[model samples]
Target: MIPKYRKQFNKEFSDEKYSQLKGILAKKGGIEPTFRISESPIFLTKEFESKLIDASESIISQIKTLPAEILQKAIPDNCRVPNDTDKPHFFTIDFGICRSENGAIEPQLIELQAFPSLYAFQKVYEETYCEVYPFLSEIRNPMSHETFKNHLKELIVGDENPENVILLEIFPEKQKTAIDFSLTEKLLGIKTVCLTKVKKEGLKLYYENDEKHTEIKRIYNRVIFDELDNIPDLKTEFDFREEVDVKWITHPNWFFKISKFLLPLLKHQFVPKSYFLHEFPEHESLENFVLKPLFSFAGSGVNLNPTIEITSAIKDKENYILQRKVNYEPLFEDINREFSKAEIRLLYIWRENDEYPILLENLGRMTKAAMVNVDFNKKDAIWIGSSNAFFG
Candidate 1:
């Protein structure tokens, strides 16, 4: 974080300005986000921004080199979909701020998800920030309006018709991430249909749109195997592996293959020490480790400061990972009292047959609690919520 921008932003920040931002977001995004919106965006110096990119590239380099057999081992057989895409179309790399042994600020890998995130909403969020803080226009945004819109269209629809490509999610209107779904539909002209509404006849999938059944050509998937496996009532006519005549924008297998499953295999300095619970050596201690369910989403089954008894009680050690807990440096101090820790998620996109994924944007989370999740943020904190980044 840059101190000068923080000071200037905080001095200029007011309750009215925040309210205006909130109203503009709800109007422009076409839906109010269920999550918190931070009062201030993280201002990044060129030096720190370079460090974040270098750290991300280092981890991605390792991910790119993983053997095919090992990658196959990461996805559960039950969750594998037909017609694997061979690579992820979208991925996000998360990093937490930490202090090196020399006390200098450093970025440590927190987690990675080989799936699409708030792609559409991030563009709106960035634009809203610039509107409120006009001076921010001088900063280099990770993605411009044209850059985001063009890349998203190419990935989701390409040469195909937008109506034939759906942003697939379950009960999308009720989900917390519905804002992104709505924004995606707005920007790309794609439909956001609920899983239950996808009518499957023979081997083709269709969704009723404006009284006509629209054929599905491709799916920009937002559904997760973890959710589908857990929620029994969330049934659909077509299973993900039913050999349906539709292309998967991002293959589901990558969700499990490149997630926490790969963390244990990575040996990067930025990546914390991680190991499969079942394969951890006897010399390793559980006191400093956190237990994470291999396939859970949104921090569902992560047990921070886990004990040996807790680790032993896990029925399937193979479905869990033990990662050494990395200490977060409280990097942002509010104008008066609240303190915050932050994490950055590097968003990337890779089209079919592309050489590699391109970094499209960056998302930041600021929280005044133990974890970066909005659920963990204390309500009284000023800068505890979601934010964007501006690089000088």
Candidate 2:
């Protein structure tokens, strides 16, 4: 992170300017973000940028050659989602700064998700960021509007009417991250339909559009298998194992195959020692480890401070992972001359024919709390919530 510009940004920063920036984002596609937006965008130096890219690419290369048998073993025998595509369409690698044994700061892997995050909304948010600070345009944008648009078209609406492709979510409007769904609809002309609303008839799926039933040719999935278990009584024809006649832009099985489930398989300098909780031998001194539920999202079910009794109480050990907690070095400067440790999410988009997942964009969070989400910190705070980065 650059210190000089960060100081300049703080000196020139105003609540009025931030409010205007939020207004600009809200006016775009006519929707306001439900989550908090940070007061500053992170500024990454060239050295830090290269380290991040190198770490991500190295992990991706290793993942490509991983045997199918190993991945299958990672998924629960009964919980495997059918129609496996083997490759994830989207993923994010989260990195946190930590001090090495030699007292040097290094980026350590926190967790990675094969699931789609706030893909559509982050792009619009970056544009609003540039609008607020034109001087920051020299910084490299990991994702371009043109490339992102074309990629979305290729994956979601390829050779088909945009209306025929739908973003599948469970009660999307009620979800905290639903703003991305609305933005996706606005940008790509695709509609958002809940899983329970999908009508399955004779192996074909359809959703009502303007009271006319329209055939669904492709699905941009946003539903999580973990979430489906809670709503077992809901009436819907949605079944991952049903073998419906449809193309999944991001297949459901990949969500299980390439998630925290795959974290233990990955060994790199940037990654920490992570083990499946059930497989880990006892008396492992969990004081330095974090207990994480494999399938939860948005920092849910992650224990920074774990007790022996708490770990022992978990009945489903296979559903958990014990990761060595990295000591987060506060890198991003705040108004009080104190820095807040940050978590950087490097986002990627894998195309149909690409050799690897393309680095699309990033989400940066600087927080005062033990964790780094809007839900964990206050909005009016000095440095916290969702943020962007200025590279150059």
Q: What are the Cα lDDT values of the candidates?
A: 0.85, 0.82
How would you encode candidate 1's per-residue C-alpha lDDT over 1-392 as one tens digit per residue?
Answer: 68777777788889999998888989977889898999888776788778888878878788888788888988777787888767899989998877777887878888999999897887788889889988778885745688789998998898898989999998888888888898888899999988899999998899998899899989999998667877766667989867888888888888988899888988777788998999988998888788888888777878988888888888889989999888788777677755688888888998778877888888889887777887788898888888888877
List per-candidate RMSD values in Å.
Answer: 1.3, 1.8
Global CA lDDT of candidate 2, please?
0.82
The candidate that wins on lDDT is 1
User: What TM-score does candidate 2 get on C-alpha atoms?
Assistant: 0.95
Question: Residue 329 in model 1: shift from native, Å?
Answer: 1.3
List where candidate 1 sits over 4 angstroms from the true fold: none
lDDT at 193, model 2: 95
